[model samples]
Target: MGSLRVYATTGLLIASLSTLVHAAKLEDTAPYPKAEAGFSRQVIYLPQQSEEENFKVELIAGKTLEVDCNRQRLGGVLDEKNLEGWGYPFYRLEKVIGPMSTMMACPDGKKTRKFVPVVGDGFLLRYNSKLPLVIYAPQDIEVRYRIWSASDKVGTAIQE
Candidate 1:
């Protein structure tokens, strides 16, 4: 019984020390502030401009970036649908994301309208910002972006 108690105490001490070490590591490497609390989401609304433009976005580890483009709006207005005179608004990421691209030629006319992600009612992109992302979008399309981060310590966005 004495030998058994000695072994048990040794094992407990090892376990406690390992736990403390791990906690220290977690504290040191944690990127988000108050990450022990949980994750958070940030949203951005981009309006149409006269020219095709690139928007730079910052990303962090363990967070995800999601983008959705609305093409059915009438005159760049959200929720103002016009079926008769529908314009197909679209965008392209500088980096190949998922199964989307500007390189893939989308045919013109009503048939081309079917190819838009907005027509399918799904997001144009859902990515983890491995690096800063550059998005290219048409002038008439409005974009809504949602970025999820695991830490609040990040405070303000270092990347726009």
Candidate 2:
């Protein structure tokens, strides 16, 4: 029984000290602030990737709407904002205004709830795994992202 207790105490000490070591290596999180009123902050933790510079992050912010059978799209301006003093990059999604759609009649007034994505500039971002991507958007807005990667082989442009 004495030998068992010694081994147990040693295991506990190793576990506790391991956690402290990992915690010390974690990136600082002091700059990211809480959400502002009427808006919520979203976080995206990217995984470490090889050659991350060849990748891009595309943020899609939009809302689901009941729509008829027509071509539809949502519009919002996604702007990049820098944190005060630290200059850490973050994104803010403006209010989604119009779901401009083609005015075509649906068969038998059929309607369906569809995720209409925002269409605008400033959505593509450079991929960096060191810090999490923070975004502030309206409470009603939904944010999503997809990763894009460049081809390994670079093609030279044709000379004019």
Candidate 3:
């Protein structure tokens, strides 16, 4: 009976400790720099994922472009920059420029405003739920991201 009570108390203590750890804010961990003029700062907080699975974070930054059903690619890039003193990472989209699109004539006569994602060298960041991802972009553009992970199962490669 005494052992059962001890286990219950221990479980509650651990749960409370876990809650406290997660409740801490990113600013509390370290100071991230402020966004410069003409740029807006964005933050992403990823949930704690299973440790066994490999995970990555990708940034999707761009602007909406008006189109007539032609395939479009936004012209711009996201440059990864680090905080001056801390060396913490952040992304910057310098300018939002063109929506270079396929010249295919639109069969339909209607136009639509669509979100054109930016393409660059890339934005595949390491997944760390403990730190918040910070991004800065021109105030005219939008910033978004997606979390990617790999399954644990490994496939045998065919011999050459």
Each candidate's TM vs. the true structure? 0.19, 0.77, 0.76
Greater-TM-score candidate between 2 and 3: 2
lDDT of 1 by residue, 41-73 (tens): 222222222222222212211112232332321
| Rank list by lDDT | 2, 3, 1
Off by over 4 Å in 3: 1-26
Worst 10 residues of 3 by lDDT: 11-20
The TM-score, computed over Cα atoms with residue i paired to residue i, of candidate 3 is 0.76
Highest lDDT: which candidate? 2
User: lDDT for each of the candidates?
Assistant: 0.29, 0.77, 0.71
Clashing pairs in 1: 33-153
Candidate 1 off by > 4 Å: 1-117, 121-126, 148-160
**Superposition error at 64 for model 3 (Å):** 2.0
